[model samples]
Target: MASHPNSSTVQIVCHVPDTLLDGLQVDMVLHSHAFVIRKTGSFRNHTVRRVMTRAPIIITTIRGGLANQMFQYAVARRLAYLSGGHVVLRLADDFEAQHERVFGLRHFNITGHVMYESKLAVTLQQLFPAHPQPIPEKIIVEREYQEFVPYSGKPALAGLKTLLFVPELLAWRDSIQLAGYWQTERYFADVPNLIRHDFTLKDPLDARNQAMLARIRSRPSAFIHVRRGDYTSPYFARMFGSFPPAYYHHAAQILRTRFGADLPFYVFSDDPAWVKQNQIGGPDAVFIDWNDDAPQCDLTLMAACRYAVMSNSSFSWWGAWLGERPGGMVIAPRIWFKSIPEFQDVVPDRWLKI
Candidate 1:
C-alpha cells in the first residue's frame, strides 16, 4: 500500500534556553505537529492502519518574553491538533539575533520539516473547512507584530486559555485608528484556556482572595484590577498613555457607586501597597496579602477574577482576557499616551476606559 501524503510526521527544535526545560512537558511536545497516519502490524497480510500523531512539538522563546513565547506554543499546538500533524519550535526566534540570519529555518538549523505553515499557507488554509472558523475577518487589522503576521490566527490561541499582554509590541504602533483595532480585540476577547502567570502576590494574599471569593455567597462579584504607573516612561505604560492616579481615583469612585461596599473588592497589582497608601480603601475593599515571599501570582489571580481593571501593561491585558467576565468590566486607559496617539483605540469595547 502507498503511504498517504497526509500522514503526519514532525521534527522539533527547542527554541528556549535549556534552563527552563522543567516548565515544559512531553505531551505538549506531541501537541505541535500535523497529524499523521501510522500503519499498525507492519509486514502482515492483515495489516490495519489508524491515524497516529506522535510528532515533535518544539518550543522556543524567539521573540518577546514569556507571554510571546507562550503564544507561539499555543498557536503551534492548535495548528498541529487541527491539521492532524505534530509541532516543533524553532528557537531561532529566541533572543534578538543579528539581522543577517536566514529566517526561522536557517536560524534554527531545521532541515527535516517545514515551519508550521507559511503566512500564505495559514491564510489559504483558512479558506478550507477548519474548526472555530478563520478567526473572523477582522482579526488581522493593524496588528502590532509584523513578524507574526504569518501567525495571524494568534488571537485564536486565546481560546486555548493562553493570554498575551504585549505592550512592547505596541512600541511601533503610533495610532489605533488603523483597521487592526478590532483584530486585537477579537483576540483579547476569544479565550479558551487562559494560563495564569502572575507571581506578584503572596500566600496570605491568596488566603484573602479565597475569602473574597467566598464572600460573594452567590452575589455577583467582580475583581477590580487597577494599575497606576508612569505613562511617559518607555518601559511600562508607553503604549496606553499614562494611567494617572486620577483615573484610579475616578474608577474607585465609580466602583463605590456601582458595586457598593457589601461586595468585597479584591485589589491585585504590582504595587498593591501603593494603591493602599494612596487610594482610600472602601468598606468592602480588601487588600490581599502581598509580600516578597508571597507565591508569584501573576496569571493565577488574574485568571481567577471575574472582572478586571487592566493596567497600561500587557500583563493586565491577559488578566482581563482570561477573566472571561460575562457582563464584567475591564477598565482601561482611554488615552494610551500623548506621543503614541496610536494606542487610543487599542483597547476592546468590553473595556470601560477612564
Candidate 2:
C-alpha cells in the first residue's frame, strides 16, 4: 500500500492465489474465507483509491510582442504536452503603460487557457497555502539570457521545479511557473504541426489583405522585412541591433538570382520612409505601409510570398517560417545579436544564412 503526502488517499496493492480468491468482493470483503479491514489512525479520514488524480497545471507568463508571445506559449505548450497537464497563460500587463502592448494570442486559433493578473492571484491563493506570498507549491522559472553565457554546455538549473532558462532546457514532468523568451524552435520541435495549427489566424482576411495575398501568389514574389523601431534606440541596439544594409543587399541579390531580376519584391517595415530614403527596394518593389493598424494582416501577407529575406527579429523570423513555399528561399543574417553568439536553434537548418 502507498500514500501521497499531500493527498488524502491510500493505495493498496496485493497478489492473491486464484483458488483462494474465489468470491472476492472488492467493495465489501477481500475473499470468502478472509476479509480485509483498515485500522483507524491518522489516515482514518482518507479515502483509499486505485489511481491518482490528474497532474497540476503549468502556468507560464506571457509578455512581449506577438512573435515573442508565441515563443513563450510554445514552451509552455511543450511542457504541458510532456507532463500530461494543461497550460495557463499569465498575461503580463505591467508593461501596458510603457510598451502599450496588449495580449495578442486571442487573435490566433489557440485553445489554451488564459488568466489575467487579478484572477491568477486569487486562484493561487485558493489553491495553495498563504505562507508563500506569490505562489505556493509552484516552480518559478525566469529568463537569464544576459548573465548566463551560452556555449558552455552547462545545466541552466539544478532543481527540477524552479528553474532559470538561459537559452533552452528540456522540461521534465513537473508543474512549473515559467517566464522566458524561449526563442528557439528546438524547444518544441516535437509538436511543430500542432503549433502551426494553433498559430493560424482566427478571423478571415479582409478585402485589402486578400488583394495583397492574390498579388503575392500571382507571380514570383519576395518579402523583405526591415525592423527598426526600438532597435534604433541606443540601449536596445546594443543587444538587438539593426542588421546592416549589406546583409539585405546580399539577400536581395540571392533572391534575384533565383527568381530573376524582374520578380516582384514586397517591402514590409515599421518605417517605410527609411526604406524609401535608402532606396533598398528595386524598381519592381512595392512598399507595404497601409496595414499599420492591422499588423497581423501584414504578417499574413508576408507569409503568402514565395521567398523571404528576414531581419534579426522574431517578427520576421515567424513570417519567414509561416510563408515558406515549397522549394522557396529564405535568407537570414548570420548574426542575430551584437553581444550574444549566433542562436543556432532559432534559424532552421534548411534556411540560408548570409
Highest lDDT: give the candidate number. 2
| Predicted candidate 1 versus true structure: per-residue lDDT over 235-307, tens digit per residue | 6544445455666656666655677655445666556667677653454466655522322244445556555
Report clashes for each candidate as comma-separated counts. 46, 0
What's the lDDT for all of these models?
0.41, 0.67
lDDT at 91, model 2: 62
- lDDT for model 1: 0.41
Residue range with the least summed lDDT across 10 consecutive positions in model 2: 40-49
- Maximum-TM-score candidate: 2
Q: TM-score, each model?
A: 0.49, 0.73
Model 2, runs deviating above 4 Å: 1-53, 93-95, 124-171
Q: What are the clashing pairs of model 2? A: none
What is candidate 1's CA lDDT for residue 56?
Answer: 26
